[model samples]
Target: MEEKLKKIQQDFLNKTKDTKTLAQLDELFIALFGKNGQLDELSKQFKDVPKDELKKVGPLFNQIKQQLEISINEKRGTIRKQIYQSLQNEKFEIPSERTGRKEKKGHLHPVTQFEEDIVKLFEKLGFVQTDAPQIDTDYNNFEVLNIPENHPARDLWDTFYIDTTNYKLQTNKLLLRTHTSNAQIRILKNNKPPIRVMTLGRCFRYENADARHEHTFEQFEIVYVDKDVSMTHLQYLSEYFFKSILGKGIQARLRPKYYPFVEPGVGVDASCAFCKGKGCKVCAGTGWLELAGAGMIHPGVLTRGGIDPDQYSGIAWGVGIERMTMLKYGIEDLRSLKSGDLKFLGRF
Candidate 1:
């Protein structure tokens, strides 16, 4: 057994010296040390050896195994360093052959471009752009917006609430804001009226996405507050904005709609540009495409914002930027806007 072990050790040293590559070293290592390998097969011979020799053979076997492992590791490092130095000394150049394809240039995403255009239009109308946190308190998101605790309207927003105990928010409830209209409450609280401000940002809800709906989406909300702000002003601004996007001669229609924060609310619709109000699939054969929800701010919401509702009136609207972009560009699927497909976005 002693003679056999010495022979195996000499063979290992010779093999290690000749090894020129990591792959070769690895193959040698497995043949000697791996399961069912040379060392493993040799260890089995202990049963056949005389009992008097067993103790000496076992200790020598373990020592050889440990030393071989260290030697192989050091050799591996040396080989790797040599390979790296060779690579560093080598020179390379690009092929001179022409591919004949023009490199593509990147442009703003359709959603981003749409957002910029909307901002420019409102800015022209003297509306200042503003932003609010995506994660917000229940009070700012719901209570201050007239959606009282356990109100049926709360069901309208399938909310995604954050764990307040885990997040340590000041309020017991924290959530991804269901609507950008929460900004209205925050704005009114911090600023004095004769205020014209717009918010364009992302909102979240628990939704099953389809052709027209998404779990997460972008929204644009504008709030205007001053004395004697009437529905006529709302109508005029809505029409002017739609015309700017949809081209001249386009018209807007307003029908009575219910909203928690707005009194005498309206559903704003535009004549479908695709079918010219003659009914089309884009408009779902209705000839009118719903654009936004707008109305006079409810006195309760105004008073909650620190403004005297009796002394002042205001109009507010929340529009889906995706919906407007789809109508303008004749896009059929809402999912495509967020699909992350460069091919689809490159068209815009």
Candidate 2:
């Protein structure tokens, strides 16, 4: 056994000097030092030899195998580095040439961009962000917001109703919330006077799809209730919001309109940003685009929300996110805004 071990070590050393390449060295290593190789078979022979001699030979055999594996791994790493460097320097052109692949970077959807811009603008004006469940009850969605079953404003939102039987506290309904305005009732119930809140989320309507309308759309709404909050406050905020979003040169006008939730309701319009208020195709030659629906909070609406209308005058507005993004970015079709097309979205 002693003579065989000496001979194996001598043979390994002799082979190492003549090894001209890394591959030849690897082949030699497997034959001499690998699991099925001579060094492994010699170590196993210790079990048949005397126990006293086995202990001394076992460690020495393992040490030799470890040293050889370490040396071979180091050479393999050096060889790999050399091959990589050669490939980097050598350029063979023509056949099957590699072309640069274009990478598509993802971005926020345009509706999201519109929502974010509006949130930032309102946040600057002291409105705290708030949210409500997408599925809401009739109380918060309509009744508490001053839209009774018989009221015309309920018509303003084509509601998607849900099963009322599955609920314990329910009598007859649930709905896919039609507007962020529902957050107002929720906000007031959870908060007290001097409440200022804004919310942006999905809203549903049962309208036909067209260049300008969608059955499903995004809505942003703001509610401010405090002592002495009035239409003037509403007007100033509206003007500032449009100017801040559309730029410094924009102008807006308000005309009388009606909603069940707001008395002295107004339809707000902005001078066409694309045409500078001179009649143009974007504005449909109307010189103004309907921008928002806003009004002073009605007495009944305030009373229902656990607030006194006499003591607290308030104003609220709902802006269509689809219209805002489309108008701001010159998007011609409302459908394109939601189309999931890379060509359309990549621009923003």
User: Best-fitting candidate, measured by lDDT?
Assistant: 1
Task: Give per-residue CA lDDT, model 2, range 59-82, as digits (tens).
Answer: 777777677677667767767787
Error of 2 at 337 (Å): 0.7
Across 36-97, the per-residue lDDT of candidate 1 in tens digits comes to 99999999989999988988888988888887888888999999999999999999865445
Among the numbered candidates, top TM-score falls to 1
User: For model 1, what is the alpha-carbon lDDT of residue 341?
Assistant: 97
lDDT of 2 at 52: 85
* TM-score of decoy 2: 0.68
lDDT of each: 0.88, 0.81
TM-scores, one per candidate: 0.72, 0.68
The TM-score measured for candidate 1 stands at 0.72
